[model samples]
Target: MIYLDNAATSFPKPPEVLEAVSAALSAPASPGRSGHAASLAAARSIHRARKNLARLFGLPDNSRLVFTANITWGLNTALEGLGLQPGDHVISSAMEHNAVARPLNRLAAERGLVWETAPADGHGFSSPDDFKKLLRPETRLVVLNHASNVSGSLAPAREIKAAVGEIPMLLDAAQTAGALDLSDAGDWLDMLAFTGHKGLLGPTGTGGLWVRPGLALRPLAVGGTGSASESIRSPDFLPDALEPGTANTHGLAGLAAGVEALLKKGVDQIRAQEMKLTGIFLDGLSQIPGLTVWGPRDTNSRVATVSVTLKGYSSSELSAALEREAGVLTRAGLHCAPLAHRHLGSFQGGGSTRFSLGPYNREEDLNSALSALDRLARLKA
Candidate 1:
């Protein structure tokens, strides 16, 4: 099958990633938990992964980074760990995925914290000006998605940072982590949530959160951190402060390999290739009658993900047809960002079809998708 759902989870990870995981699992002991030779080697591997991630993101201290199960867990750690009190205000955009929205909404309901949503432009992008308008003196935290999962609309983090100076910002980088250049996050963003399975091309269950130094977050879990074992209380520090229990060593080993592969290939080169395919697909889809493409038409302002709706066919029907008849696999429906769909005016009807590209996608995949859409349009007609 021609997989076009890389925005959800990348497929066909590099050969090195598979090898690394296998090698790590074959070893005898766990990392950071023992003093044997095998344990030391495993611990070193984990440290190497941390350092690689630090280099990829241009972070100075690799130890500050904490691993989680996925981006959802990272986001939750950032949100729940902040320990916001009642009546405190939190800001987010309408383009946020359920991962960000669900936690914030829960806090608003149970903790009596205030929540406000900023409006996005026509392209489903949240503007800095709109964010500034929503800012109140009581606003304690600002959560923004680096890219919309549905429309692939990117938010201007630099502009938003300039507007809301010193206000702690939590950036969800699930979509943009490995695809976009974000090395300058240390200067502007307070916290970043990232997933290894998506753009990072790692196996599932690998993700992390990076917080600025001196930011204190309450521990979400407390038990067996391999440090301060004599004490019942969790240690108050970065990494061990949030990461409790045994870590996902196998997944992290694969993630380390995946990240190294990305660094070698270069993010700019990957983005350019994906954009080339998106341009071809968008151009062909636009030529088809009764087709409406969503998000910023400019490829520069968006990732390789594109959402579209055919006039007469439901998104599910179009996706199924593409998979069955054309050998193209694309995602359909709300894409877990119903608020984004509402913003794009696709919620009243069925959600739009999503085609997300990865490094493995080729020019032929775009051509095949376009050709299938062309025929599907004629069939509807």
Candidate 2:
């Protein structure tokens, strides 16, 4: 099958990632569960993965990285842990996925915390200046996306950081973690949540959060952290403070391999290839009559994700037709970002069909997708 849903979960993980997962299951159980040779081996694997990811993001201390089940878990952990009391203000962008929106909405009720979202522009981009205008002195936290999942619109995170001036920033790097260069995050970002299954090219059920130094978060859930066993209370150290219960060592093993492979290939190289594909795809889509491509029409300031709608086909209809007729798999509907869809003016009629690209995608894949879309558009006409 031609997979175009990398924005949701990447397909056909790297061979090294597959081998690592199998190797972990055969070697040992979860790390820190015991000091046995098998367990120590597992712990070492986890450390290696952490170190690789830390180095990728330019983080100094790998220990500050905490693993979670997914980006949603990491986002929730960071959002809820902020300990916002009544009347505290939080700022975010309308392009945020529900992962960021839901937690803040709940906090608005639970702690009387108020939140203001800067609306994205016509191109589905949230400008740094828009956020600057909304920032209040009481704004306790700034939640922003590294890129929009719906349109792949890259956010000006660093520019926003420069404008915020020390207000703690929580970044949702779900779309840009491995797809874009984030080595600069170490200095400006207070925290970042990433999904391993997406751009990281790892299996699902594995993700993480990176918190900068001097920022403390209240633990969401407390239990056995496999450390400080003598005390009944949970340890308030780096990862031990956040990680509870047995870790997903098997998934993490694959994650390490994936990150290692990405580091070797170089994010710049991957991005260049994706940009070439994106430009070709966008140009092809624009030529088709009765079809309107969404988001930034050009390849600049965006990832390889492309969204579009046909005159007669709803997003779901087009996706179903593409999969059934042409074997082109895509994601349709709101993509869990209603505000973003509304901003793009695609919400009223459902949402846009999204074609997300990854390292595995090729020029042939884009050609096939465009040919299929042309046929579909002709049918609609």
Candidate 3:
């Protein structure tokens, strides 16, 4: 089967990732929970994973990295931890996933925050000026989706950060963490949230958040961090303070291996391959009649995700037909980004069929998908 749903989660995780998870399971050790050798080994594994991810993102201090269940958890932690008072404002892009939107909505309802949306253009592209215009004296923080999961529009992170100076920008790098080169992120981004299951090619239940030094955020939940058992109060530190529970050691082992694979392979190489596949798919899509593509049609301005709508066809119908007729897997509907779909004019039509590529996708896969789409397009004609 041709898997084109990398935007949701990646498939065919690296061999090392599978082996790492298996090894962690075989050992049956809980990190920082015991004093035995196995426990020490588990703790070491977790530390290595944190270090590798910090290096991957070019973060100077590895201790600032905190593990979480996923990007949603990280986003929530960052948003809620801000301690925004009444009349404070938070600005985010219009092309945000439910992760950021829902959390911001909750904060607005509970904390009386004035939530603002920075507008993107018709192509889902937003400039620094868009955010600059929305900046208010009461603005406490700026949250940005580094790239749109629906439209695949890459945000100008550096520019936006510069425009909203010292506003504590929180970057949701869900789509670009492992797919793009972010070695310079430490210099620009104040906080970053990432998921390992997508472009990192890791198992589910593995993700993290990183905060810049001197940025104080309240812990979302206070529980046992396997540290400071003597005191009833939670520890006031980097990771241990934020993390509260038995860690996802199994998934983190796989995540560490996945990041190792990317470090060895280099994200630039993976991005180049995905871009080639995207260009080919876009070229093929243009040849088909009655097809309208969304987002940036070019490869340079977007990730490998491509969204499109066909005349006289619902997105659900097209997705089902693709799977039934050609074994081509694709995701349909709003992709949990109703705000994005609404902004891009795809909400009323039940969203659009999304075709997202990964490093594992081949030229033949794109060819087969294009051929299948051409045939499906002719069905209504």
Q: What is the TM-score of each candidate against the true structure?
A: 0.98, 0.98, 0.99
Query: What residue runs in model 1 are displaced by over 4 Å at the alpha carbon?
Result: none
Error of 1 at 272 (Å): 1.5
Candidate 2 Cα lDDT to native: 0.89
> What is the TM-score (0 to 1) of candidate 1?
0.98
Return the number of clashes found in candidate 1. 0
lDDT per residue as tens, model 3, 1-381: 999999999987999999999999999689999999999998988998998999889999988999999999999999999899999999999899999999899888987999999877887788999999998899999999999999899999899999999899999999998899998788888999999899988899989899999898899899988999999999999899999998999899999999999889999999999998899999999999899898888788999999999987899899999999999999999999999999999999899999999889999999999999999999887
lDDT of 2 by residue, 1-381 (tens): 899999999987999999999999998476998879999999888888898889888898889999999999999999998789888999898788999998999999888998998876787677788888888778899999888888888888899988887898999999999998998778778998999998888889999899999988898899998899999989999899999888899899999999998988899899999999999898888898988777886677888888888889989999999999889999999999997888888899899999999998999988998999899888868
Q: Candidate 1, overall lDDT?
A: 0.88
- Candidate 3, 88: how far from true, in Å? 0.6
**RMSD to truth, every model:** 1.1, 1.0, 0.8
What is the Å distance of residue 106 in model 2 from its true position?
0.7
User: What does candidate 2 score on TM?
Assistant: 0.98
Error of 3 at 145 (Å): 0.5
Name model 3 segments beyond 4 Å from true.
Answer: none
**Pairs of colliding residues, candidate 2:** none
lDDT (CA) per prediction: 0.88, 0.89, 0.92
Q: Model 1: which residue pairs collide?
A: none
Q: Native-vs-model 3 lDDT?
A: 0.92
